[model samples]
Every structure is written in C-alpha cells, then in structure tokens.
Target: MRGSFRRYTRWFIAWASLVALGGWLLPPLVNVERYRRRLKSELEQELGRPVDFGAVSVRLLPRPGFSIQNAAIGEAPGFGDEPFARIERIECDVRWRSLWQSRLSFDRLRLEHASFNLVRRPEGGWNLASLIGREAPARGGTAAGSPPADAGGPLRLESEGARLDFKIGADKKPFAVINVAARLDLDFTRGNVNFRLAGEPIRTDMSLPTPGRVELEGEWTPGEKLSGPLAATLRTEGALLYDWIPLLTGRNPDLYGVLDLQADLRGSIYSFQFEGRGTLRQLHRSELPPPADAMPATLYARGQFDARERGRVVVESADASFRDSILHSSGNVEQVFSAPQMDLVVAVEHSRLEDFFQLARRFASGAGAAGLSGRLDGLVTVRGPWREPRLGGFFKAQQPRFIAGGTTFPMSDLDLRVNETGIRLAPVRVMVAPRVELVAEAVFRPPAPPTMRSKQISAPSPPSAGEPHAFGLRGLQYDLALSAKAVPVSDLVRFSRSLGIRAAREVDAQGIATASFGLTGKVWPITPPAWHGQAELRGTRLFLPGLTEPLHLPHARLEISENRIVVDPVTAVIGTSVFTGRLEHQGGRSVPWTFNAHTSQLSLEQSALWFDVLGHRPPLPLLARIPGIRSLLEQRTAASSLFAGLNASGRFSVATLTYPSVTLTNVVASAAVSGRTVQLGVESFRAGGGRGAGDIRVDLTAS
Candidate 1:
C-alpha cells in the first residue's frame, strides 16, 4: 500500500510541475479581438448608436491590450453630420482585471489625429447629448435624469500626439483646431484628470482661419462634476481683430490688432473666478469704409471676473489704458443674469470724453469734436424674454466741456436718462462768463430715415398723422427749455472766431435771455423729419459795437415760420425798425440761402454806425476826426429819420462768404417793395458837408 501511494504522489507532483511550467513559458493570455468586439457592442448598446472600426488589433505581451485604427462612433443626424469623431489611430494600455472592478487602468492612449464636430443646435441643444445615450427631451417632456447606465467608466487616456478639428453649422467649416501632443495623467479613483500639451507649439485657428499658436496645461475632474478647483495657463499669439470685426459691423473692418494673452482661471461649474490680462500691440485701422478714420494704437486690457451665485456675475475690476494716445479708461461692471432678465451697472473713473467721441464718430455722423474729462456712471437694465432686448439706463458726467465749431461751452453738469421712450437730459448749466449762467433742459431723438443709406434699403413706416391714438410721434419726442442770464453776446462772437466761423467784428455786450420749446423727430427709420415749437428770445442791454456808434436793442419779438421770419416792432435806436423776411434753402453742391427783407423808418445814422462797427467803413475825409463819417454825418435835417423803405433780396452761399457778390436794383432811399426787387430811390444826405442823391443800382452777385 505504501509503494502504490508513493507512485500516485510522484505522478501528481510531476503533473503539477508540468502545469506550472506551461503557464510560465506561455505569455499572459487574453482574447484581444473578442474584447474589442465586446467593447464595440457595449458602446453601441450604451450610446444607442452604431460603431465602426477600420482595423482592430490585440497584443498579448506584458499585459493584455488592444488598439483600434480609424474608429468611429456614430451620432445623431439632425444634430450634425460629422458627429462621429474619427480618430486616426488609438492604442490603449488597459488592465483586464480592472475592467471587472468597474474601473479601467490604461497605461496610455496614443491617438494620432482626430476631428470633432461640436455643434450648437438652433434649439439650443448640444450634439454630444446623444453620445452618452442622453437625448434632451422635447419642450413639454420632463427633464432628463443623471448620466445613463453602461455609459462606461472613466477612461484613463494619455495622448501621445494628435490633432483635433472642430466645425459648426451645415457647411462644416473648421472653426477651431487643437493640435494636441500631450501627456495626460488621469486617475479615475480620485476623479482627477491632469493634462499638459507640450510640443512644437500647439496651434489653433478661429474666426479667420489664421493660425494662432497656443499652449495649454490644465487639470480637471469629472467625478466631481467639474466642481473641483482647476488651474490652467494658456498662451496665445498672433490673434487678429479684423477676423472678428465683421461680427460687429456687417462690413469687413480695417482693424489690425495682434493679441498676446495670458490667462489664469480657477473655478467650478457652479461658480467661477478668473483673472486675465492681454496686450494688444500695433493696433491700427488701415482703411475704414465710411464715416470712419484710422484709429491710433491702443494697449489692450486686463480684468477679472468672479461669480459667487448662479445668476450674478461681477466684474471685480478692469482697466484698459491707451499707449501713445489720449484715451484711458478703467471701470467696474456688475451683471445679473436671470431667465428673461438682465441688469448691468458700470462706473468709469477718470474717463476722457474726447476719446469717447473719437470712438463714437466711427459709426455716427455730426459728432462734434468735444473732449470729455470726468467720472462716468451708468446703469442699464434689460427685462423680458423677448427677441429684442429692452434697455434703460441713466448716465451722468461731471464738469464736461465741449469744443465744437469754434465754440467752447463748459458744461457744469450733464445727466441723461434713457427709458423705453427716449433720452432726456437734466437741467444743464453752462458758464459763458463770470456771472452768466445758461441753464438748459432738452430731449434729443435720433434722426429719421432717408438720412442714412446702406446697401439694403427698407421701406419707411406709414405716416401716423391720421391714425394717432395716444403717442405723439413714432420715433422720438423731446421738450427743451433754455435760459441765460448776464451772458455777453460778444463772447458768442469770440467763440465763433475759434470755430473758424466768420464774425463781422467783436462786440462787448451783456444780456439776459430765455427760451422754451419742444421738438419732435423720427429716428433714421426711413426719413429724417423734425418739428420744433417756437422759441422766444428776450435780451436786455444787448450792445452792438460793430456799428459806427454803439447801438442798443431794448426788446425784440421775433416770429419764425418754416420759411419766413417776422420781427414786429423791433425796439432799436433806428426808430423801431420793423422787418419781415422770407428765406429759401437751396440744396445741392452749393448751400445757398435766399432772403428778402423789407425795412422801414431806418435811421441813417444808426445804419452808418452799424456799417462802421462791422468794419465796412466808407472813405474818410482828411480833415475829419472820425474816420469815414465826415461826409455821412454832415447830412441835414428833421428828415434825418428817413422813410427808407428798403426791399433787399440776396442769396448767400457758404462758398461765397470770402468774396461776397452783391447787387441792389431799383434802390430808393425811401421806397417799398413794389415787385420782386426793392424799389428804393436814393435821397441826398450830407455827412459833415457833402450832399448827394441819385438812383443807385447795387449788383450783389458781381464779385
């Protein structure tokens, strides 16, 4: 019995040894092709989509592994065409035991090149939604739950070298590119995914297909639902502004700005905190289409944003300073975003208004050259889920000065409020002199249509004159009030001189004036139309030094019509000269204004004084103390207050201001307007000792 047991034991030992030797000599065994088919089947079942592969290979070396060449996972059609991301090649180093543990341990995943089409659907959904077997429900359906089962555990992927292309819309134009050759360290256990893309400069193209060199290093965690704090630094070079300019203005912008950006962001999906700084060097505008000139070089900006809540985003601070230029701005803004609602408040300190005007003139016309220097405070609010946003705000500027058309008007304070209706200005006080104060309140609407033209012309809205219900005008409505006290009219003349506007002569005079009116105008919807109420001007001690002698106009009541002006009983030293006039505007290449004025009971002495003050002095006699007046003052008599019924017709154009042409026909010293021309008969008058009277025909058109 002992011998038989020994034999059996020896046989068992020998068989066990043979089995151990067989395991040691053979490699780690794995059905790689079977695993690949299983993976494909599992992905199809999980994603509810077909999966295809160009080639599948398995390796049984140190550990079981597999590789797929040109693998494609199908996506929904309506979402986008190129939904399946085709990887050039994929090699994964995976641990088989870990797969049973509901985990994947991949030593590395070498992906050569791939393209992903990330599309934002018209209904505001994502194309990637179907990849995880999660389809967004129709409008009325209940919200979807968490991620679907069989979604496959986190993938521990480390890319060797790869290129990624992204497209949007139907055209499938490449909007973004990511040339990635990075070392990705992923730990599914800790829910940490850290990656660093380092190579011969990872590049991308956005907006204009211009290559932008970029470098990225970041860490992310998916199990934490991106809630874990993340740190990344991205460097981008050769970013162009002209590429995105067309988005702002339908036309291609002539802007040229290169970008050098550095960003540091750390945040979660719920709330984010970021601080970034970028420099724009060599900023220039080569050729603007119209109404815009080339701009100066400007330094970019640096700013920070922090969001603590879901709906609130705060601009911790931001600053943009100009280089070798006059513009400088630093501000802080806060924004609240809620469903169908948004509100923003901005406060700018040490803002230059002149620089602001320069920026504005690029898109608008009739913008005067006025520099602004002060603190700017503004608040804007938008409400509702409407297609067009409704906005309202209030902007205030302190101590703003305006320099336009040769005039300098220093405004003490300017405050404007914008509502659903239009823009209204608070009472503004202007300082023209030490004691002079000009207070004004106004509302300005935009110009009507037909004033501006674009490539596509739109029809104007029908007039509302016959179908008015409650509103006044369709576009803009305004009411203005202006008052002045102790203002020197001579200062107006001085201001005009600076504006290059011709002034007869400078005069020193003080007066108090007040006017109130209302204006209604349409925006540039179709045609520019405006209607203004009458304005009344009252002045006292208004002196005119341009005359041969100082003259005072105590009071004047002027009525202005569309094409006519009637001054009723003007209180003047000229024995109350009353005048009525009509003006006609001539359009086209020349801006000519035609006027006809009839005057009566005009004092010759006063008229002569005006001419002398205007610097249009007649020839002076050698023996006379007063220049040019020796012969004029010598005139005799009780008839000194001549019934000089003067009918004057003349046309004045801006081009003819330098060399004026004048023609006076059928002039009578004491006559009235009998026809188209003034019927005036010259009367004899002596200045000092000379007397002369003759029919004089003055030709004003002859230069």
Candidate 2:
C-alpha cells in the first residue's frame, strides 16, 4: 500500500513539472500565424471598424489567450483617412471555464501606449455614431442570431499611458489629454459595462501649465445608437484654468490659477449633470502674484455638460464663500464652442468687495477698486456675447470708505454697473464731515479686446446707438463727474486742492458754495485730470484786495477751465458804495493776472479806511462778511506775495465821487499801477457845483 501511494505521488509531481515547463517554453515555439486572422476578425466585429494587427502569440498562465502587437483600427466612414486608434501592444486572456462550456470568453485584455482620435463632424454628429451595435458574422459556420462556438463573454480591458485627441471633422484641435490610464469591464452579451478613465488635460499653447489628473469612474450600458445611461464620480486637482474656463466661456482668457473639483456625475456621456465643489485660487496675471493686501480666488461651483448640443453647458448653481460673504450664480451658455452666448444671473449676499476687485486684478484692470471694504449685494444679469456682455442690475455698497491723498472720503452709498458700454460707477454718494456732501459718477475704460473687422477698409461703420450712454471701447480713459450743493467754501477749497487743483487759500470765507465739474483722464499712471465747470455764489461778503473790509456781494460767478480761471463781473456794496469788477488768471500758478474795475459814489473816509498799510488803521468800523478777512489779507500783503506783480494802465470814469468837504460829479481818471504803487491823475472833476481841471494824485497806500 505504501509503494502504491508513492507511485501515484511521483506520477502527479512529474505531470505538474511537465505542465510548468510547457507553460514557459511552448508559447514562444507555437506558431500563432493561423490564429492571427481570427483574432483580427473578432476585434473588427466587436468594435465595428476595420482592424489590422501584427503577429499574435499564445498565452498559458491563468488562462489561454493571445497577445498581439501593433494593432491599428481604421476610422469610420466619412471621417477622412486618419485611423481611429493605434496601440503599441495588446494582450487578450480567454476564460478557460467559459471555453470548456463551448464559449470563448475574453476575461482580460490589456493595451499599452494607445492613441485615439475622436471626431465630431461639422453637422454635429460624432464619427463613431453609426459604426457600433451591429451584429458580427457568426463563427464556426453558425447561423445569424445563433450563438457561435467562439462567442466571447465579458472583457476586462485596460490601457496604460494612452492619449485622446479631439477633432472637429478632420482638423485636429490644439487640445488633448495625455497619460491616460483607463479600464473598461464590458459584458457584451448583457450590454452592461463599468469604466474608469483618468487623464491629465493640457493646452498646446505656448503657455503650458502643469497638467493634473482628472478621474472618472462610472457604469454604462450602450444601446443601439451608442447612447447609454451613465453615472460616475469625478475628481480632479490642480487642473489648468484654460481647460475649465472654455467649457463655460468659449474663449480662452489670459489668466493664471489652479482648479480643484469633486463631484458626482450622472446621465449619459454626451449629456450629463455634475454637482461639485470647485475651488480656484492663487490667481494672477501672466504668473504674477496678487497685490500684498489682496488675494484672488473662487468659483467653487456646479454645472452640466452636453457634447451633442453644440458643446452646450448650463450653469445650474455656482457658489463661493469667504468668511461671511457669499456669491451665488446660475446661467446657461449656448453654442459654447462656436459663437457662444451667455445668459447668466449672479447674486451676491454680503460678499466682500475686495473679492470683486481681486478678480478684476487678475484679468485686465480694475480702476478705483483699491482700498475697498464692506459688504456688497446685487442681482445682476449677464447676457449677450462674452466679449461685450450687457449687464442689467446694480452692485451696491453701504457706507464704504476710501482713502486718497491722506483724506478718507466716507461714502454713504455706492452703485456700480457694467453694460455694453463699459464699467461704470454711477452716483457714488458721499457725506464726508467738514467737506461737502457730494455725488460722483465715474466711467473707466481699458483697451478693449480685439474684434473681427471687415475686410473692406472703406466699409461704412455702423452707428452705435447709445444705451443712454456708452463708454467707447479702446484707450485708457477715465471720466469723472462731481456735483455738490450748499457746501462750505473752506472745505470745497480743501477738496479741490486734494484733487491737485489750483484753489483759493489766502482769504478766510464762511459762505456756502455750489460746484460741479466734468473731468477726464487716465486714472492709472496718475495723470492730472482735465476739468471744466462753474461755481456760483450769492448773498455773501468777501474781502477785496484793494479794500480793508469785506463788501456785500449780491452775485458772484466763476468760470473755470483746465488752464484758466475767470471771475466774471461782480456787484458789491460797501456803505452804499456800489462797485463792479472782473478778474482773469491764466496758466494756473504761473500767474498771468488781469484786473479791471469801476465805481460810483465813492467816499474818501471809506477809501482812507481801506487803503492804509498793514497794522495802520483809520479807526472806522470795519464791515466784512467773512471773519478774519483783514488779517488774512494783511498777511498776504506783508511780503512780495501772490498779489505783488501788477501792471495796470487804463482810463475809466466814476460817475460820482464825494466827501464831507466837497463833491465831484462825473470824474474821469487816468490810472497807472506798477509794483506796489498806484498813481491816478484826476484829469477833470466837478466840485461844489463847478468844473475844475487838474492832475491830483492821492497816496492810496498811505496812512
């Protein structure tokens, strides 16, 4: 009995050794040339395309199969001459148990270094739309619809380091995703499958960012039309900004950022929904960091995609949050790849204003968006083409403050808008203490994006019908309009100086002044804005340089321009002495000044009281509207000051001049003024009811 057991064990060991030796040695020796045609036929029938391959070899471990090299699959009809897929190597493992049941099953198949081209025809149909789902030729002489002996069962296929090229018809695009590792568990008999595709998307443009892997795992059941119900979970980290932005906005913008997404996907591969949390951050322009105090971020969002619907995309919900601020958006983009038009609604609820500025800083430019804080809320609709979108609705802020030139302008409210015209901040209301309550409106325009122009240079251009108004495209232009009513003169003067305007400073005034201006320049590069406006004053008293006390002025008007200042004819009275005068100053601080005046019914006592030197008084009661007018004037006159240079040679007449001792009627005087001296020759005078002719000079600057 022991001898018999030992014999059986020895025979079993010999058989096992023979099996291992044959598994190692027989595969290379076996001639698989005859099976090559059958394998090629099977692959062609399965994929419904023309297939070619190099020599096939037998496999022995785990299961019986074949390994083929240099397999190539031709493109479908009407897609030109380019092939569909080319693989460096292919391995197929047949299920032994299924083969014993008279059915050949491909349990596993592997491909290496494969490249595939997917084309979408100009008429919106995929190239592979009609090639799949057709019944294959029966094997082993079996009739159609009858199961063949070589019928294959489920296939678990995998590819390592593959590439997918996207094409519109025969023209391949400059976009492809590479380094793909994919798996497909396909059950041909049951029409059910599970798949996983992971790849890194890249842009072939000159600026090539580091691509990141995006993964999708899903289940699919292909129907007759190749339309299948599919579901998947998609994940990606550090993807290119251009790859994702073109999905919503057709054009690829010049921007820099990283994108991360995690989502559950459902529906068909051609049309599907993706609800995800997406985060974008580290934004910049051409790889430059954001401003020290600001950061660029956002768009954690969700949306839908459809390949068949002209690459249509719908933005169902997009939300981004930073601390207590929230911004939500929803919109749909149609014809996303060609002639894209967007209709989106964005809502902000207590969102940070700095966030908006940060985004603007990443793109082109955001003028006047610095030093901004506070909550912003709005419901804005963005429509039309992406190049020039029309915005309806407004973004507003409450009690925002801005610091400029060492002054904080406390704003009561702000309203901002963007339309086909440009970016506008209309009616930014301010109520600053010690200054005026002002309403400022501004429009900022950067160089517009290039647009397609007509080939004919002489073509008549179409007139742009205004949207009430439009800030024309191109140029670095900033226009500002400011208006104020019943504001203090001191504060107004201070504010003008802060804006780098030449303003009044010598006199102390206490009257309300009304002012408005329209200015235009470039806010960037810090250009001094050119402005034209007018200021009006009424029912106030101010010091005149030639007089010692202030006079009551019924009306005063000033015409101001970029380089000139004009004080129009003004009417004033001092103790029933009516006077009128006009002064003009050109070239700002260079001080080319012109002054002229005439007066009637003047009194010598008033002249003596006004024309005396500083610190020397005539002892008459001083009457002035603005307090400290005399002291201010005296300080200005003490030195060779702003009023030192005067050249005057003119003739004028005062209808009446009178004193307590005598009265002169219809007196004509010739005046000459140079430096600090004024000589007026009384050529003719009517005194004591008689006419007297002489040259009488009075020392008006004396005590």
Candidate 3:
C-alpha cells in the first residue's frame, strides 16, 4: 500500500512540473510588445466595437499579464462623441497555455478608475444594447485558458473605483453612482452573466448631505437580454429630507431628519418588483430642537415597476406609522423620469393623542400642530402633476389643548381641509379665558414651485421627499378671523402677552370688550398684519396722564383699521350726569388721540370742576424731581404756570353761577382748549332775565 501511494504521488508531481514549465517559460520567451496588438484585436472582434489603449508593459510576478494605460471602449452609433467606458489603467492576466501555443489570451481583465456611460435614447433604445449579448464572432482563435492559436480572451472583468453615469440622449445627468467596485463573470458555457456591484450614490444638484452605499448582485442570461431572472438590493443610509427638497424650492427649511431604507428588487430588468422599508427620525420644522418625547416615524412599500411605457410604478402596498398613528396607501405613478403624476389615496388613523405625531408635525406647523392631542382619522388623496399637485383631504383632531408661549389653551377639536385652491381651517373653537370662547378660522394658499427639469421628484404625504414644507415655512400667506365673546380686557392683554406680543404685555387697563375682527397678512418678515373690524366697549375706565380722576368711558362703537382707531359718540358719566362727544386715535407720535365733550344745564361751580379734571397735566419726569416743580407742573388751571399739553373744543350752557362777589344766571360760554390754557369766549350774560350781549375773550389762568 505504501509503494502504491508513493508511485501515485510521484506521478502527480511529474505532471505538475511539466504543466508549470509550459505556463511559466513560454510567455516570457515571446516578445511581450507583440501581444498588445493581439489584445486590441481580440477585444474589438469580441465586443464588435472600437478599442483604444495607450502604452502597455508586462507583469511576471505571481502572474503573467500586461498593464495598459488610458484604455477606452468606443460608444455605439448615434449615442455621443464620448466613449462608452474610459479607464485610467487596465490589467489583464495571461493564459500560459495559450502562450505555449505561440499566441496570447487573457483569463482575467481588471480595470481601475473607470467611468461608464449608459444612455437611453428618446426612441426607447439603450447604448448598451449592442454589447449586452454579442456572441463571439466566427473566428479562428484560442478560447480562454486553452493552448490554441489566434487572438482571444475570456469574459471575466473586475473593476475598482469606477463610476456609472446616466444620460438621456446626448445630455448627461448630474446624478451618478460612484466609487464602485464590481465583478462580472460572462460564462458563455453556462449561457449566463453573473455580476456583483457595490457603490455610493451622489447627487450633485443639491449635494446630498448624508450619503450611503448601494449594492447589487445578480445573474442574467445574455441571449435572454440579461433578464432571464434578476435580483437586486438597494439600500440608503443617513439621507436628509432637506437635501432632496431644497434643490427645487431654493430654500433650506428647518427639517433635520434622517432616513434609512433597505429594499430588494426581483424579476426581469424590464419589469421588476420591489419591497422596501425605512425609518425616519428627528422631524422638526424650526431651528429649535426636536421635542424630547417625540418618536421616530417608519415607512414601508411593496411595488412593481415597469421600465416600459415611460416608466410606470404600481404600488401593491404602502404603509407608514408614527407610534400608534398609521397610514396605508396604494396606487400607480406614471412618467417617473419626466413629469411624474401620482394618483394615490392615503388613509390615516391616529390613535394616540398625547405628544403629536412626527408625521403630522412634518406637514402642519405652528398653530396647526400646537397642542394637537386628540385622535386623528383622515384620508389624503394625492393626484396630478408633481410640481403642481393637488392635495384633497380632511383631517380632524379631538380631545386636544392648544398651547402657545407656555400657555395651554383649552380646545376640544380641530378640523383642517386641503383642496386645489388652498388649505383651510374653518371655525376652530378654543376657550381663551374662563367665560370667553374664541372662534377662529384661517386659510393659506401655496404657490406652485418651479420644477427641476427631468430630475427625480418625490411626493410629500408623510414627508417622503419634496418642498411642500417650503410653501408653509417661507412663502405662507393666510387670512385669519377671530370672533370672541365678552372677554375681560385684562384677560385679553394676558392672552396676547402669552402669544409673544410685546405691546400687550406692557398695557395696563380695566374694561370688558368683545370683538369680531379679520386680518390678512403674509407669514414672512416682509409684511405686517393689517387688522380691520369693529369692537364694542363696556364698563371701561382709563386713568390719563394729565388728569387725576380716572376717565370713565361710556358705551361706544370702536372702528379699527391698520393704523387708526375711531371711537364715535364718545361719552363720559359723572354722578347722575352724562356727556357725549367724539374721539379719534391716529397711530403716530404726534397727538395720538383728541377728544371733545359737552353738557347742558351745568352749574358754574360744577362746570369749573369738570374743566379742572379735563385739563390737568404732569410735568417732565426729570423736572418732577424738584419738590415745588412737580406740584406746579402737574396741576389744574387754578395752579399751573406752564401750558397744559391737552386740546379740546366745546360749547357749554350754565343754569346759574354763584360766587361770593356776585351771582350770574343764564351764562353761555364757548371755550377753545389748547395746551393747558383755556380760551373762553363769553358770548353773553344775564343778571335777572334782562339780557345783555357781548363778545369778550378771557384767559382762565391763576396768574
């Protein structure tokens, strides 16, 4: 048994030695330069396309091969002036047995830093059609790894650091799959081509911020159009929503979310079916940090894509969820590579109310998402062109409390509707204060954003990839109307302060007011709100700077506009007496308000008291620091030396005037008030029904 084993081992060694001698010595013995011409010819004949290469050098360590620099394969007819594949360097291994036959052949071809261009013609033809399955031409040549004559090589190709560019007709696209390493085995014996590829996708238009790797491995039969059966996997990691949306909208809004997806494709290349799932996190519309208690969103899809008919995609199943809130959609999308249009219906049901859904927050911002606590049930229909899509839907939330500026406003429900014209929310009710209920409604119209020609456009339902958020954040314009019951003026001020109004926080007053006002404005820095409506005042009182007594106001109609306030039929009440007049306030630094009041049957002594209350003034703040100056500057006409800064004009009638020196009956006087000075024009006076008429000007000042 030992001798039999020894004999077999010796025979094996002898056979290996002979094989080594044939493979090692013959290729070096032949002039390596002559093999370069043979290689060019073989590749041209096999591929049926022109081949070009620069210089060539031999490699004999560990393997025998040649290194060719600047190699390129010519494009098919009518494609472009550029080559189909351009390589920085090419390396191929020599078949030793073929060299022994006094001819050269390559068993393996490796390419470095190569770039491949794949073009699709308008007529639905591909540039790679001529090369996908061109059978070896009828020529006398050595098959790969064989010891025969004639120029030939195998169909095994490996490449590193390569890029695949896509083009429509002669125009190249800015998107590419780059830094790719691939291996392809074209096994004619098995009538199939097996390929494995790994690469990173790059989008130059918006400079994709967070990119990820994509890999594919599949086998195809050449004669069957390389689609006898195919399977591929697509994966995306760390993708940002802003990067994809800002390219078209020209605005980088406040979303800082990340999306990760993994998908698998199966079937022929022309008609492939796919399924994918992804996770979305950190959905926020402002620079403020995302809510700490917010949960990430998830998405899934299963669909079949047809490359024919301008690229059709029919979704079999699509689902999205944010915790307990879920949505399901399915439909078809056509013209994917051009002006895509989708007819998909997304039905959503939000079961959890606390801490709003991230998916909902992505579409609705500011007041729309504020204190959205209730269960939501709705359906959204996505349809029409990609750029000018019409979203038709109705969403309602219940059992919620709206909060703004650290105040929780009690609200029972919210309803929103979207149609082709715009987004609208009608009749939203909330309890602003204990007994005052506020009813508000608003609407916003979004202008159609321009499209990026022939670029990938994604519809935003659950915030997949689009600029719908831009129209909300930067270009939004809404008309808001608010109607309220009799709200206490203090509560109104406090509520306004809670909403971040500086003017409301600084105001001090006591009154009850009810208003029905409407305003229109753009939600941008360029425009301020324009308010127009009417308000009613009751039980109102205000202490003026020039008067010590609080000016008790009478019921009046307030007409309000952008820059002015008008109080018509102004009134004042004193113990068992009432006076009527008019008041106007122009929003300006000069004399913000002016008022005039008059009363008949007033006693001269009582009328003197009314004049004192109406014409009082306070001194300058700094001058008031002096003891005597304060009392002198802040006094009625009986004490003040400086002019009182106030103005009013009216006519009064007196029943009787009593003084220690004299008693005058039936006194009529006209007064012009100007800056703490009373210009009195006594038209006439009577002492016992005997009338005397006179026009006399008198200055009423304690000089």
lDDT of 1 by residue, 404-518 (tens): 5555677777788865544667777766655666576765443334543122211122222332222222344343555544345555444444455422122234343343323
- TM-score ranking of the models: 3, 2, 1
Superposing every Cα of model 2 onto the true structure, what RMSD results?
12.7
Q: What's the residue-level lDDT of 98 in candidate 2? A: 54
Instruction: Please report the TM-score between candidate 1 and the true structure.
Output: 0.48
lDDT of 2 by residue, 479-595 (tens): 677777888765665554444442244444556777777676654333567666777877766554544566677777887776777788777777667878876777755444565
RMSD per candidate (Å) reads 15.6, 12.7, 12.3
Give one digit per residue, the lDDT tens place, for model 3 in 1-703.
9999999999999998887776676655667577667878756654557889998777664688788899999998888888999999988777777678655666778999999999888776677656655444334753432223244444678999999999999888777888999998765444467788888766666655524566777777645444456777777677776564563344565466777888888887788999999998877654545666446778899999987768899999999787777779999999887778888888867655554444545434343323445677777788887655667888788776766577888885778887656667758778888867788877765534446321221111122244353233345566667777678766776677677764443333468888887675665422556676777878866433333334566687777676777878767765335667676766653443555555544444443443334443322243432221234333433233223534555565555556556666677766666654566766677876587555545454443
Where model 2 places Cα greater than 4 Å from the true spot, the runs are: 1-18, 98-104, 122-152, 204-211, 242-252, 290-314, 354-370, 403-409, 417-423, 429-433, 436-439, 444-478, 481-703
Native-vs-model 1 lDDT? 0.47
Please list the residue runs of candidate 1 whose C-alpha ends up more than 4 Å from where it truly belongs after superposition.
1-83, 87-114, 119-192, 196-216, 224-229, 234-261, 268-271, 279-340, 348-366, 374-410, 417-423, 434-437, 444-489, 499-581, 586-703
In candidate 2, the residue pairs with backbone N, CA or C atoms under 3 Å apart (3 or more residues apart, or in different chains) clash, namely: 278-300
Q: What does candidate 1 score in Cα RMSD to the true structure?
A: 15.6
Per-residue error at 496 for model 1, in Å? 3.0
Question: Per-prediction TM-score, please?
Answer: 0.48, 0.61, 0.66
